[model samples]
Target: MSPTPEPGLPARVRVHEVGPRDGLQNEKALLPFDVKAEFIHRLAAAGLTTIEATSFVHPKWVPQLADAERLFPLLRDLDGVRLPVLVPNERGLDRALALGAREVAVFASVTESFARANLNRTVDESLAMFTPVIARALDAEVPVRGYLSMCFGDPWEGEVPVDRVVRVARRLIDLGCAELSLGDTIGVATPGQVTALLTALNGAGIPTERLAVHFHDTYGQALANTLTALRHGVTTVDASAGGLGGCPFAKSATGNLATEDLLWMLEGLGIETGVDLDRLTGTSLWLAAHLGRPSPSRTVSALSPKES
Candidate 1:
């Protein structure tokens, strides 16, 4: 594949849309299954090839996505899209497998505080637990994506070390994850920090091709960090439609890098993401109305035509 228009970027970037699952998970109002299904359908129709549909986590933990079992069945008609769901443990993986999930994602944090708060396990313990889960997914022929949260900074621990992040990431990749998504959970990462982290990962021999970046727009640095990652040759990026979803564990964490926002930049840079920005913006606008608030995405706010 050719490099992107930017001197060192990839020719085409693959955007992994996490809106339906991630976006709605953080909402105060619980949407009906039909509404969630429609949103997923609209997102896929807007040219997102990989849309994370839902998570198989226990309802007690995240009441919003308790409908995962019911939701996946309704998404069968979305034929060509890859709908990966988050599976936090063996039970979650089992639930996903029973529902015929072809791709699943597992999440862990680099900081011990985050690991304990989020999963009730230490960083090492969480990694140990995922080993079996990842093995099971691989045995079942399902591609597993490992999500390393708190890659740049942690709310409880402050600035996270790059080596700590790299160690956890290496462990995940070694444990059979097909790809690793480094997440700035608190949205506190700057472009310089992003560069240093990627550089360290590269030095550790993990090619950018096996990685994706997940950034929060909390400090309004998501796009800048994404641009740095793209320059480093990382092609896959995780974004939520309509700027939905925030870290429940991190109080200061606001929202993800919006799909519309990322699309606007990609479109301007002449990068082929196969996404229709106009259609995506329309989706966000519709979702905003349903959520009873304006979208946080600058691109969506700027591009959406006003009602007469």
Candidate 2:
């Protein structure tokens, strides 16, 4: 039975599934191109419209996705789904464009520490690097999405200021990004902080429609924070299938908000995501078997067959 509909929540939510890229990027074992392609196909089969397929970063950086060039062709035939790949810079953007990618996303950091650690450049420097990338992608008619990490708290620099995040977010918007995904990279954000950040962004002229939230489950607040965002009129929520993915750059960060778990909450609240929980859970379980482990998602665990 579904819970009573809330007054302020959005009628529908778009779940941006990030398992293929963000989830597998940090894995110790390298999966074959076929497996990766199958994973994405299965995700699309489960009704995920906007699936982050892979990253175009150099193989030296994220070796797991080195097969990006070969993997993309397999997904070209997937209809009615938006497969957005992550491009770290102009080079990455070039690769993605060459592959006929329809959509792309660039990762940015709001804090200097993570900016240096992850991208080896300061916050402003990283944005400056993305300037040309965003311009070229936009010129080519490819929609660009900006991912701003470390929005709430930074491991090196704790407690990010709302104004600082707003400034960077505005710059990304000004740089021709169609949408901005604010990431709680360390997953330390709570309900109140989520409200504060969304309000701040609104005050700075960034509408809720153009924004998405990507929360990690480090402090076990991913769901609570997501609910806060939904109430604030944010319709796009980022989650990983089976609770896979964390920042390889930020070791302190944990798995992302699980898609099955998020689906459970949304279904219970009478919110529509159009995702088949049973199929998605099965996909996670299949992947978990390939990776030699059980899924970390609570929903998957609860719904999986129990042992005798």
Candidate 3:
């Protein structure tokens, strides 16, 4: 409800934890359905209200999440949290609906190359594909979230035009998306680029409150880019705990900005996110132990007493 914080201080950013979905999707060892369920439970126990639980795309694409049908039901949001599952098409929507999902998400890239590689379709094709899916979700009373990847830069497409971004974004919100998340997929965005994009979106009649932001830490620009977006009035932010996410298709790209780091910044800025920073650090630690890798979060790094 309040504005994002200024530089060198806290931010009003609301961090959405994506660890259960993004973090586990790329894992080499597939966790059992129960493990995934418990992971989501612990995330909620830590005071994170928004948790991106799983994707409903076909099993052939991401075999790790093939059990999403089983996973979603197990992690059902019976209370106190919003669990948004990723749905890319009618079939994904059907799967989400069958499992009693209250919210769903769809994605389209800001660049042609990324769109083609990520979804095997052109940008417009991807947007067109979601028409029926969005319609179905709305009909079923399921909230739909739109994810626009590579909002700032694409590895193969070079600099993305602001007009392209605005055009795609306008279409998403127009099509019934409850929220639009601008993603710097390969994390090539600078703070200035973030500001410019958000400014244009605001001028395009897309309220800052309706737009959310997702940033990768590839070049260590995620936090800075997040700051720029917040200052421009964006509130919802997508982050994975312990920095537990990355794009398999994008070369050299790193994880999403860590949830703990974002929470640290938000708490400092006096934003009331209703997230427990200490509990968040604990979840990050538990996850790092499960994954056997160093967490990529600065706040978790400072909080975790475990030897490096």
Q: Which has the greatest TM-score?
A: 2
Q: Each prediction's Cα lDDT score?
A: 0.91, 0.94, 0.84
Candidate 3: where are CA atoms >4 Å away?
1-12
Q: Write the residue-wise lDDT of candidate 1 on 46-161 in tens digits.
A: 99999999998889988999999899999988888999999999999999999889999999999999999889999999999999999999999999999999999988899999
List all candidate RMSDs to the true structure.
Answer: 2.3, 0.8, 2.9
In candidate 1, what residue range of length 10 has the lowest lDDT sum? Answer: 1-10
Residue-wise C-alpha lDDT for candidate 2, range 1-308, written one tens digit per residue: 65778888988999999999999997777999999999999999999999999999999989999999999999988999999999999999989999999999999999999999999999999999999999999899999999999999999999999999999999999999999999999999999999999999999999999999999999899999999999899999999999998988999999999999999999988999899999999999999999888888999999997889
Lowest lDDT 10-residue stretch of candidate 2: 1-10
Q: What would the TM-scores of all predictions be? A: 0.97, 0.99, 0.93
Per-residue accuracy of model 3 over 110-168 as CA lDDT, tens digit each? 78998898899998999999999999899998888999988888888788999999999
Pairs that clash in candidate 1: 4-10
Which residue pairs show backbone clashes in model 3?
10-269
Q: Give the C-alpha lDDT of model 1.
A: 0.91
